[model samples]
Target: MARYKAPTTRLRRLALQLRQLREETGLSHQQVANETGLVASTLFRLETAKTKPQLRTLRTLCDLYRTSPERREELEALLRAASEETWLQPTAEYLPGPYAAYIGFEREASALHNFEPSFVPGLLQTEAYARAVIAGSAPKASPEEVDGRVAARLKRQELLTQQEPLTLDAVIDEAVLHRLVGGKAAMRTQVEYLREASRRPNIRLQVIPYETGAHPGMHGSFAILRFEEAQDVVYIESSTNDLFLESQEDIGRYSLMFTDLQELALGPEATDALLAKVLEED
Candidate 1:
């Protein structure tokens, strides 16, 4: 069955604003439900952006919160915007839960701080590198499914080449370069692409050598996405439930971790040299 999730930029903003309004009133979900005759669960879904908010419902809640006209109009606009196509469109409805949301956020982000201990970051991955990573990890997926996924991923790489490209600061583990995902030849190609991509003004790539033992990033990979207009978000990929951490505290921890990794990792010049060496050895 096809999922019906729309692009979530405007939806996400509405979610945050709705939660903020509710918090300002200091009313429990149950209290608001009772006053408005709305179900508590429905309110939860609305605040979390799980459901497309009905206009009547939004109006009722706005009344309950005693929102000023200006603030209410802002929210109404977001609701209207949610129904429109967003940048990238979040078109792959079959993308796993929260995965589409992450892509949607990435599309609108101004800058990204990424730490990848396993493979290259999606934004930096070449088509072949992405194909190897996808196919190797999900051997059971049909060739058609793999092809579709590979295409979707490559589409994301466009963000890096766009006129106003997303600024990417990525710290990749040294071992990632050595992994011959598609074969020795394919890995070499991927490394060469990385060397070229690193020189782009929008991308800042670094490599952490094997000598950096048991670092903060050893446990897992995560990304901190910063927006020009909104608060920062920390994304942690998981086998089961991928997480989007929006709290200031969570953002702080991940930001500091990336800073530490950046300091420990080689500079761009060193990274270029290291990739050159890997290509020679391969």
Candidate 2:
């Protein structure tokens, strides 16, 4: 239910440092704005990581805070890292801000656990299936927008193949196996692709059967992304807005929920069998 304009992890760290610096100076946001001749709301957004900090703004704050040489060097390092262009940058205009942030998280994460109660997880989806999903979900989207989205989705899959590949443990609802997205033939191919993808050492796929009845995932689909250097984050997508939960409490709760979903879902062998059965039905 919590929603906000999400920022990448480095930006988050930079925001915290900037806020701490301001706190050390014992200056209120209003006071800082008066000193720097910038709007208070703009300062507030910088501290909250809601907006990207430009070089001039960063330099202005550093000067106002009288930052030490050592600390200033660290802040500059983070600024460069945070502003570095990513693969998603080219297609960002086609994506929702939060969704773009989600992919950014995916690209940097060491591991990810996802729960889907509806269609296939984006990373595991085929090109045709992804096209169908984009078209169906955003009926108002232009042909170019759909293509860009689909391209982005496929690009996300590269994480599984990149050096030190991302470890993905995805648990999907049983209902998804029967829900046709593209068409019968397309669905069959998609399922077949899943069965093959599950064989990879880095990918672990499971299914939560209907027999389990109502469970934690009944709330909705979500993913837990883990990073080696940064903190773990929970991403929850919705029709209207998306969420990026970084608090320890939210991370702990979502991590526990993903564990519960994994238990409720079938194991590796059983999931393989189920996918095979679904393919037969198709």
Candidate 3:
């Protein structure tokens, strides 16, 4: 089944700030709820990001929290950004859970660090490569659904080419290049696409050779997204489940893992050469 996704970063940030401010004021959730004429559960859901806070709610919380004008402006700005129409929001019902949130974060991220031990990272995937991956992963999906997914994924690639693009640092395993996702021809095309994408100034691509064997990335594929004003987030992707980690400790572990992978992986020059070689063999 395609996962259901809702953009969560803006909402999450606003919620966290509200909770923090309330705590700083030494007001319990119930106290704030009573003062604001909101149910405790409603306030709890807002803070936990289970519900999006309305503008009225935001103003109320801000007033109760005694925020300075500058702080209040920042919080309101965050609310606006969160409430804005994200590319994926219209299709959130069709996306996988947490998947939409990840894309939402991707849209606003200043930089992205990706470690892929499987197929190519989605941001770097070509249309054909994405179709192959999506088809193989969801054999039972309807043709229309498949087309929708493929379209959404290709649209996601716009982030790479947008004016003022995000910096993408990707570490792809050697096995990923070796694996034939589409047919041999399609795989070759995907490799060539990767080669070209790697040449872009905003993208830094590396390949970890097979000889490295059983590395830290064996645990699974994960992405660390860094934002301008929002907190850093780590996304862990597995076959059956996906997790979003925001705690500093979780971010640290993934950040260090990417660093180690970068150290162990081939340099850009060698990575280019390796892709060229793989293409030749293909």
Candidate 4:
């Protein structure tokens, strides 16, 4: 249940198309900038999807590259899409660009496999737990902003109970259970929620113990989302940056890694028992 922002999606697609056309033409970023009268930094931004290009700028790039009429029309369509507002526009203010893209991906995904080594995944977090986690991570955020984000996250959980629920397979590191993210009471409730969520038919919760020494996901946490109409994407998030990998090779590698991690984690019955033991200790 990631937060949504509308504008970034269109911008991202346009950027990707621009980069692809440049690559096909074998033009360097500086070369494209020089020929199109656009700044090198701007070209770079468009290619890497850091910013949205104006309509005129997009037309200029297409003209410089001698793109076909059909292709130009397609790019314009992308631009138009970028200009449209999304349903989650109210929550767009606080969300960063990459996160906005993640929300878009999450909304379209048919199934999601998430592995979290640190905090609990957002889709499963209770309101109080989510508030504490966000506040701790973003200390400068106003209370109202935190509440908005919490509300957004809670709204995302509706996908779980929808008529067409997204299949969620979550692999959590055992350490997350003991981290005490939101104080004793909040953590207690969170752990209890995890136990309750595990009861759902569409959700599969597994725990990778500390003893699973040197597993493939030891480097970082990632999620591989599978969509019905689109290709699978692997999302990797860090403290300050996030990456979305759509290339088949990269997605395949992460999928393999997820499978391996799933193999090493405790089975459902054993995982439930372990969770119960932790709750008792708490």
Candidate 5:
């Protein structure tokens, strides 16, 4: 069976609310199941976002929980939203469950703030650089599979150039520029691409020098995606999976971490100057 990806913004919010309501009411999954005549595992799956709940099932759950009329209406709206296909459908065949969630969040984000500690962020990677990274990371991937991912990633870049382009503030650890992901020539071209991308009005690129040691974001890389109406989400990627945080508390913590990283990073002018110096070394 294909793994189920977590729902998009609206659906996620609804699920969060559902979980909150269950907690507030002090109802265990088994208790809720007993009240609603649904299986405990089914209730658990719905709350944990392991499965998408049907509209009727959602309405029943809300009714059983005695949710506010306004909140119920909001959840119904999310149910409607869940029925729509995401823009990331093209890459669904290749993307794992967690990655599918990332693509879904990327599609709706009005602004993206990302910090990369090891390599260039996906949206900023040049095609050659991206191909090199993918080749090195997934040696077993077929040529066709690699091509499909590269195409999808490049297409995602168009979001930065659209009529209503997303605001992209990307901060990179200075080491990423020096790491040579694709060897000397490829690295030089990648640095040049970053330099050009930084010139765009919608993009703000900064670099944190290696000298700035032991920062709050040293643990891992993350992106905070802000949408117009939905709450901001924090996406944290690991070697095998990705986690999305939507709770106000978790989002606030990640936001603080991003702010600290931003403060430690070089200003755009200085960052651009440093990038030029790196390119010269190549």
Candidate 6:
């Protein structure tokens, strides 16, 4: 995704820029908060991307920072981008709490590096497979809720076909192929879909064999999204929580892990063959 569409990153980018400008003037967060009369926590959250900054607050910071006209205008543009109507806004009520932010970034990502040790990534799942997985995971969800969630998931896949397609490089553990989430038929169709999706020019799929046990990704499923202008973000998921990491340190660690896993997993051609083999066995 590009910065134009990923407002979540725009917020983050603006936050980072604000922090940088403050640092350039040798002003601490506490000092800036005191000068601006904004609470320290507010400045902290703005810098950390935990909260969106209001235009007034931003203008105050720019004034304090004594930003050049060109730089200030660029920051204003970023602020506008941050407030732009995001793709996630329409389905806001249905999406899981943190997922809206994640999708906001995902929508504008130019390339995605995803690793799933359990199930197929959402972007690659067939509708029936998605429904089955959702039903199993959220057993108490009303049928309407389940349908809304399914629709939202399917809608997210539009990024793959958008005017500027998102290039996806995915690595799945062999266990994902073995676990039957939706029943045999659903699983069968899911695998078939993976095989076809992998063939797309923008998609790259790999599988880590059971033999390559105990890898970095064994801990959980995570994705690294790359944007045209914003720094890369890493998303880590658990049954109960979703986390997005943008720090250079965090990005570096996940980036290396992904590269290592890619080296250890089957290449694209072999992965396709493995998918075909799994389909036949199923």
CA lDDT of each candidate? Answer: 0.86, 0.90, 0.87, 0.84, 0.85, 0.87
lDDT tens digits, residue span 89-179, model 6: 5556666766766888898789999999888999999999889888988888888778877887899999888887999999999999989
Estimate, for each residue in 89-123, the C-alpha lDDT of model 3 and write its tens digit. 55565577667778878888989999998989999
Q: Candidate 6: RMSD over Cα atoms?
A: 3.7
- Residue 275 of candidate 2: its Cα lDDT? 93
Return the TM-score for each candidate structure: 0.89, 0.87, 0.92, 0.74, 0.82, 0.90
Give the worst 10-residue stretch by lDDT in candidate 1.
Answer: 86-95
Candidate 6: where is the Cα deviation over 4 Å? 1-7
Local distance difference test, candidate 3 = 0.87
> What is the lDDT, from 0 to 100, of the residue 252 in candidate 3?
92
Off by over 4 Å in 2: 1-7, 23-40, 63-68
What is the TM-score of candidate 2? 0.87
Please identify which of the two predictions, 2 or 4, would achieve the higher lDDT against the true structure: 2
Clashing pairs counted in every model? 0, 0, 6, 0, 0, 4
How would the candidate models be sorted by TM-score, starting from the highest? 3, 6, 1, 2, 5, 4
Q: Model 6, residue 269: displacement in angstroms?
A: 0.7
Give the TM-score comparing model 6 with the true structure, all chains together: 0.90
Q: List the residue pairs that clash in candidate 5.
A: none
| Candidate 4: clashing pairs of residues | none
lDDT of 1 by residue, 38-122 (tens): 9999999988878878888999999999999999999899898787764434446536647777888888889999999999898
| Candidate number with greatest lDDT | 2
Better of 1 and 3 by TM-score: 3
Those runs of model 5 whose alpha carbons end farther than 4 Å from true positions after fitting are: 1-6, 17-35, 61-74, 246-249
